[model samples]
Target: MGPKIKQINRRLNELATEWNSFDLGPSRRETHSFVNSSDVIGRDKDKENIIDHLKEPSEDGNIPVIPIVGIGGLGKTTLVQLVYNDDRITELFPLKLWICVSEDFDLPRLLKLMILSVNKEENCDGLTVESLQTCLRSLLNDKKFLLVLDDVWNENRARWIELRDLLRSMDGLSQRRSL
Candidate 1:
């Protein structure tokens, strides 16, 4: 592995070990079997706004990218999860995908994840970027898909453009919505 990758792996291992050693007390939050819309308190307005945006028609013939930007621990993920599992959302789009794009913004990995999400049996290993893009384009052709890229941390505009362009290449892919 490269030096940067090795360093990151080592840091991740250390963090994992440190996290496993932590034991403060019992959990304060109540665990639920499922999070209904009612479970998300004080976010009705946010939910409505997002749902409205989802229902809005795109005038530019391009996928609408709605970014929910907030600092950590502000229930950003919770809000998204609620929207993702919402009944209206589930019924609106037939194909739904949730991808958590954390610190590492590897394009190939993200593409592979999308492909695997849609076609679970496909072997994505040893596939080049062109092939992966082709697979994604083929899978999403003439289909309305809802893709949620959560926890995105990458700031490289070029990388984002490359990924976005690949997604746009799919037939009828960029004419709908994204989050």
Candidate 2:
């Protein structure tokens, strides 16, 4: 009975931790790619490192995923903004798409956001996943592009793989980078 009680307590603690983590109260303000370079300070070295990585050729022929991870309020987004706005990045990838992915990782919603990033005027409200993929492929085909999926919080491996495979299906995305 004692061991069973301890096991139950352990399971309860795990459940509590999971619950607290998911009970995020307020919605975070969506982030954008634009930033005033003059206002940012002290992240030059980090920015340069990411830029160097981006400039390097992908040895594996896969779309390189560069994640800027840190605790909340630590300016991860700010550093990424600096990298995204850099002239070198712009020169390397002419077509840039920035999507603020907060919390939920719905595939159709993410697809719609990607489409909106490509063309803001696009009406993507009623489109299915197939349509969104087709449209995104049209915009990205044979073009050097950079996609920034910002503030991602999804932890599901299958969903991530689905998104990755979706990108992999595109023609010119083999050597592109996503941050």
Candidate 3:
């Protein structure tokens, strides 16, 4: 009975260690494709801007925050989507992460989404905002990540500040520049 209990404990430990290994999620090639953002119709300039920035991150390592700020229906999301799916840019950052921010930007939700975006198997159910932030800091502290905060409203300044603060906390994440 004692040996059986020890064997069970050893198996549990091995399973636990196995679970600790990172990333076990679904493939994203099935979704988040530029084809889904077909409504953007014509935004060649915007696509160019995104490409320019992405290119810098890939080739030159010097593209700024290239924000596509404008009123609604300007195809900001579509432009970014096109650039995101571009084959050239894909090879640049193999660690690509995409996050959606409509209006409300909750810290925990955003962090969990970011984690899941980067590491699909990341389980953030019991995690808090601080915990998630720490995880993001750990993941992005040394890595260069391109984040798209889509459809942000100009109304909520406080939430925006919080989100900005979290992003700013990242060391080498975003490089602010004009497009």
Cα lDDT for residue 67, model 1? Answer: 93
Tens-place lDDT digits, model 3, residues 39-158: 556676767766765665423433345667787766566677787777766666556666666655566877888788777777889988888988878876766556765555546778
Off by over 4 Å in 1: 1-38
Off by over 4 Å in 3: 1-33, 36-42, 56-64, 174-179
lDDT value for model 3: 0.65
lDDT-based ranking, best first? 2, 1, 3
- For all predictions, the C-alpha RMSD in Å is 8.5, 5.4, 15.5
TM of each candidate vs. truth: 0.78, 0.83, 0.64
- Cα lDDT tens digits, model 2, 52-143, are 99998877867799998888989899998999999999999888888888987889988988888778898888888899999988877788
Model 3 earns a TM-score of 0.64
Compose the digit string of candidate 1's lDDT tens values, residues 3-26. 999999999999888887896433
Compared with the true structure, the alpha-carbon lDDT of candidate 1 equals: 0.80
